[model samples]
Target: MIDIHSHILPFMDDGAADYDAALGMAQDALNDGISTVVATPHHANGVYMNPAGEIEESVRVLNAKLQEAGNPLLVLPGQEIRIYGDLLDDLERGQLLSLAGSRYILLEMPSSRVPRSMEETCHELIIQGYVPVIAHPERNAEVAEDPSRLVRLIELGALGQLTAQSVAGTFGSKLQKLSLELCRRQAVHIIASDAHDQLHRPFGLSEAYGVVKRELGSDAFDFFQQNSRKIITNEEVIRANPVQSYNKRHRLFGIFSRKG
Candidate 1:
């Protein structure tokens, strides 16, 4: 499996502290059936600033270490950029990194509220032929309060990615329910382990896939898995029509089925 988001690069941001910790995290991911991990360190998020060039160098160093250790896992360069007004300018300046050098850009928003410029930003990104994928929208308070906000973003051609731990109930039961709700609404397109460390945030992609298969069925599992592969290859992902008017009474009605 391909995990499209992670912070396993040592000394990059708040992820693994050192090479020892990063190697351990890579082993954990390997045990979880993940074969490729995109090292997405925080970029321009106030606390951290990982430029595209730096991230590429970091990924190369990590991959070299993994190779020396005889680990088969592949590490790709990426960045989890916090949305800001100067985002487009930064991208044009080649300071931002897209996922696996694909057209898909991993984007993060404030957990407290959706940005007022989100719609415009997403629109602008789409116009530039770049897909902005909002990371962990299920955990965002604004999205949890009203899922339609996420639906609106999806309609604007933005995608949503759910953190694996959120889907596996690691954060809490409430967030797990919301994660499943977003899945049912077709608002989320990918599942990734936004793993920081083995203890606090471990790799839960496999567990989350199991939950999706059991609760939503195997079709939903395949959908997310296939989308992850498509994203790294810069292919167009199949987006099901999101249920705009989410009804609690019909929670199980729209779980994803095989699209092709």
Candidate 2:
């Protein structure tokens, strides 16, 4: 499986602390049946600033470490860019890196709230021939309150990526419920292990896929896995299931349920 979002690069951000930790994360991912990972460290998020060139080089170094350690897992270049005013300018200046050089780019919104300009930024990115993928919307407080906000962005051509831990109920029951609801509504297009470490934020891709298959069924499982693969290959992502706009009020009264 290909995990499109991860922070496995050493000393880049709040991910792996060192090369040893990075190798450990790679081993964890390999054990989870993930053969490829996009090393998307935080960029322009007020603290760390990893440019395209630096991330490319960091991925190379990480891959070399993995190879030396006889690890078969592959690490690719990416960035979890927090949207800012001059983001388009940075993209034009070749500062931002897409997932594995694909047209799909991983974008991060503020954790607490979805920025007001998010929809417009997504539209602008689409116009520039880039696919904007929002990372971990289930964890965003505003999105959790009103899922329609996410559905609107999806309708505007943005893809939502649900974190594996959220689906596995690692964060909490509430987030797990919301994650499942988003999946049932087809609001999220892919599942990725936004793993930061082996202990706390470990790779849960296989386990989360198990939850998806059992709770949502085999078709949903296949749809998410295929989209992950398509992103790496730069192929057209197929959304076979029709998306449903989420109704927050109805969700509490049997709007979401386990497969019977």
Candidate 3:
């Protein structure tokens, strides 16, 4: 399987702390049946800044190490860029890196809220021939309260990627339920392991796929898996029917009132 999002580059961002930890993360990914991973360290996320050229170099070194270790895992370059005002400018200036050198970009929104200019930024990126893939919308507080926010973004030519841990209930039952809901509603286009480490944030791609297959079906599983492959190869992905907007008041009340 191809994981389009992961912070597996050592000494980059808050992911693998050193070379040893990065190798361990790669091994964990292999154990989870992942053959390819995009090393998407944080970029312009207010904490870490992994430039495109630097990210490419890191991927090269990591891939060599994995090859020497006989892991059979391929590490590709990518960036989990936080949505910012100068995103387009940076991309033009060669500061931002797309997913595996494809036109697809993994965009990260603020955890608590969606910025007011997010839609505009996404539209601008689309106009500039970049496909913005929103990362982990299910975990965003605003999106959890109103899923239509994500649906709207999808309608705007932006894709959504759900994290494997979220789907497998690693974060919590609430996030797991929300992730499942996104899959059921066809609001998510891809499922990836946003793995940061081997212990706390281990790769759960296989488990997530099982959950998707059991809860949704084989067809859904195939769709997500195919999309991930398409992303790395720079091919057009298959999108399901647009998600229907839910009644915000009813959905929010039910979501909060559900028994754990």
TM-score of each: 0.94, 0.93, 0.93
Best candidate (score: lDDT):
1
Q: Mind giving the per-residue lDDT tens digits that candidate 3 earns over 15-90?
A: 9999889999999999888999999999998989888989998899999998889899999999999998888889
Question: Which ten contiguous residues of candidate 1 have the minimum total lDDT?
Answer: 251-260
Greater TM-score among 1 and 3 belongs to 1
lDDT of each: 0.91, 0.90, 0.88
- Across 164-219, the per-residue lDDT of candidate 1 in tens digits comes to 99999989999998998888888999999999999999987999998888888887
Q: What residue pairs are clashing in model 2?
A: none
> Candidate 1: TM-score?
0.94
lDDT of 2 by residue, 1-260 (tens): 99999999999999999999999999999989999999999999999999999889989999998999999999999999998988999999999999999999999999899999999999999999999999999989999999989888888888999999999998999999999989877788999999999999999999999988888877678888999999999998865232432334444222233556
**Which regions of candidate 1 are displaced past 4 Å?**
244-260
- Which TM-score value belongs to model 2? 0.93
